[model samples]
Target: MKNYHTHTKRCYHAIDNEEEYVKAAIQSGYTELGFSDHTPWHYDSSFHSTMRMEEDKLDGYVNTLLKLREKYKNQISIKIGLECEYFPKYMDWLKQMLHDYPIDYIILGNHYDDTDETGIYFGRPLTKQQLTKYVDNCIKAIETGLYSYVAHPDLAYYDTDDEFYLQQMRRLCETAKKHHMPLEFNLLGYKTHRQYPNETFFRLAKTVGNKIIIGTDAHESDALLDMKTYHLAKQYIERLGLELTEEIHFLR
Candidate 1:
């Protein structure tokens, strides 16, 4: 119930404000809420490839959240976090950023597997070979001892069949299990795609028996505190007999 990957408008695609998100969390009866905006990757001035809080606004963003945390002390607990996109080259800098800043936690969001030849993404697809490499990089990122959780391990499943994608997801599950890292069952994709976990990915995740954590991945005030898709997905997970770990606690 601790929504760990909520976003704000500075990310360019979100539609919520910090105060609105906090109020929504309280209204939904959550005790804790963490705002994790997408961290900026080093890209050569390309809007499509890189989405983040501009360097100039970074201080304001962090300070505003810090102030909100104090303001909402009695109402709820707020944590400042980052849903970092994976880029191995920036690992050191990312580490310093988190250490130097007042960040509470970090989560992995493997939006891009690698930097393209152009030093920026340009509609490249994930190959089986590339998927394996990318996942390994993500695991290494986890080994860096920075991330608290990982979001959407099956993100590159658009091109493959169930069996093929399941194999990919299993690698992530195995890695997470080995590292004791938690996997987030994101709900935003369900709202847009109209199928939770994209079918192949969810079925495979359930079969593999990885420790699961529900994440709404909300970018709006309403969804920041929502449990609709999460509840629906949990129902399906129950029907499938996937084991929910004893630590599956809801914030709301």
Candidate 2:
């Protein structure tokens, strides 16, 4: 098995070092593992983000993972990546980082609006206008060919009974299918019973013929050791009739 949605302590919200995760992946019988800790943006304003790593930590994040990728080459394949948000004003800086770093891949988190500096978190209930903007923003990000997949693609918590919810997410799913970007059925959400990785969204995505990928979303090293949850999620998605994938595009 392979997982590409792992995180590291450098992101502030995650725990342990990169090595711990690598070791845990090996113990969990995974053939490949990726570290996609939350990325730091070069904010023009003095605003700081509490969830991601600092801008200066970017080099260390990549370098440390590169060394581990080499060290563990005999045992498990390691990928160096970041869980990034598509902030329009900061795309230039993000592009520079992608070009400068040996980043294997990145996944779109889409946690906030144009910028987290706006304090508009997408996880919360959003207004109709905000939802429309959110879907459009995600579509634009997918079109960039920068992100490997959409992590927790059903993150926005809209009331499922509303037809508007289905319409907006269908648009997002169709775009993902068009771009060949798999939507992640995040294991972290499954283990924690988070509202996301929602069945309704996946059903809609299946109707759009979007492919599904399972992401460990491991905030802690031990999270990788949970084989039961992983298999359960695997069976769940497979039974949904959604095509499952383990491959992700590299940042070539």
Candidate 3:
């Protein structure tokens, strides 16, 4: 199996060293493993958080992963990437980082909207305007053709109005279908019992024919290929009759 959304301790919220994750992937029978730790942003200092690694640590992150890739080349295919929230202001920076680093891909994880001026985390309650803006940003990010897939597309997690949720979600799925961008059915959501893998979102995606990929979104070593989580995702796919893709293709 292949998983492209693993994380590293560099992202403070996660635990364990990078190598531990690699070993876990091997033990879990993953043929292809990707390290897509939460991306470090070049945002203004005032907007910084402990959510990601520091900008200076990017080189080390890449170098360490490259070394592991070579070391484990005979055992598994290793890819290096970053999971990032799309902020238009940092698009240029992202482009340059991709060019400068040996990164293979980026997954758009729209966990936050608004801006340094007034941003709101997705985990908290959102205003109607914020929800609309979240969907708009997701669309704009996909249009950039820079991300491999939109990770946790159901992360908007709105339960206010069924009609509004369906409308916005359908729009996102339709856009992804048009661009041939796959949407990730995140396993972390199932493991954490978070709002994602929302039945309504995937049901609509199935109707719209949006491609799907299962992401472990592994924040800790043990989460790399948790069979229980994998089974849960598999059941969801089977139940929804969703089309699942094994790999991601970068637009660039």
Candidate 4:
């Protein structure tokens, strides 16, 4: 199987080194694996977070992954990528990063809104206006055509009104369909008993015919494809009859 949304210890919240994750992928019987650690941002304004690697570490991250890619070329296909949140203020910097680095792809994981100066984390309850803004930002990111897929498209949901939730979610799905970007059914959320893979959202996605992809969203090495978790995700997909996109074209 293939999984693009993986992480490394460089993102402080995750565990283990990159090579350990590679070994885990091989042991898990994966033919293709990607390392999409939380991306480092170079914002003009002061922005600090322990969740991602620092800007200076970006080169080291890419070099290490490229080395591993060549070393494991015959064993498994290794791809280097990043899982990023879109802030329009840093969009140009992100594009420059891609051009300067050997990044194969990027996945838009919108975890916050506004800017580094003032942002709203998705974990908290959001007003309808805030929710609409989140969806608009996601659509804007997709329209940039810089991301391979939209990861955890349902993550923006909090305690918003059911009607408003459905309305905004449908809009997100329709925009993804328009851009031909797949929406990730994140396995990490399922494993952790988190909010995503939300029934209402996926049902809307199914109705709108949005392409689906399964992302391990692996923060730790063992999470690559733990058999039980893998089966649970597979069953969820099968039961929903969602159309799964197995491969993606990297940015050239």
User: Which candidate ranks first by TM-score, i.e. highest?
Assistant: 2
lDDT of 2 by residue, 1-252 (tens): 999999989888889999999999999899999889999999989998889999999888888988998999999999888999989998999999899888889999999999998848888999888888889999999999999999999888788778999999989999999999999999999999988889999899889999899999999999999999999998999898989999889996
C-alpha TM-score for every candidate: 0.85, 0.98, 0.95, 0.97
How much lDDT does candidate 1 score?
0.70
Model 1 lDDT tens row, 161-206: 7466566667877777777777776778766773335556666666
Q: Show the lowest summed lDDT stretch of 10 residues, model 4.
A: 114-123
Model 4 misplaced stretches (Cα beyond 4 Å)? none
The true-structure Cα RMSD of candidate 1 reads 3.7
**Model 3, C-alpha of 214: deviation from truth (Å):** 0.4
What candidate 3 gets wrong by more than 4 Å, as runs, is: 114-117
Tens digit of lDDT per residue, candidate 4, span 14-115?
999999999999998999998899998886767688789999999899999999999999999999999999989888889999998989999998988956
Cα lDDT of model 3 by residue, 75-151, tens digit: 99999999988878878888899999988999999988844335777756666777788889999999998889999
Better of 1 and 2 by TM-score: 2
Look at candidate 4 and tell me the lDDT of residue 71: 98
Indicate which candidate wins on lDDT. 2
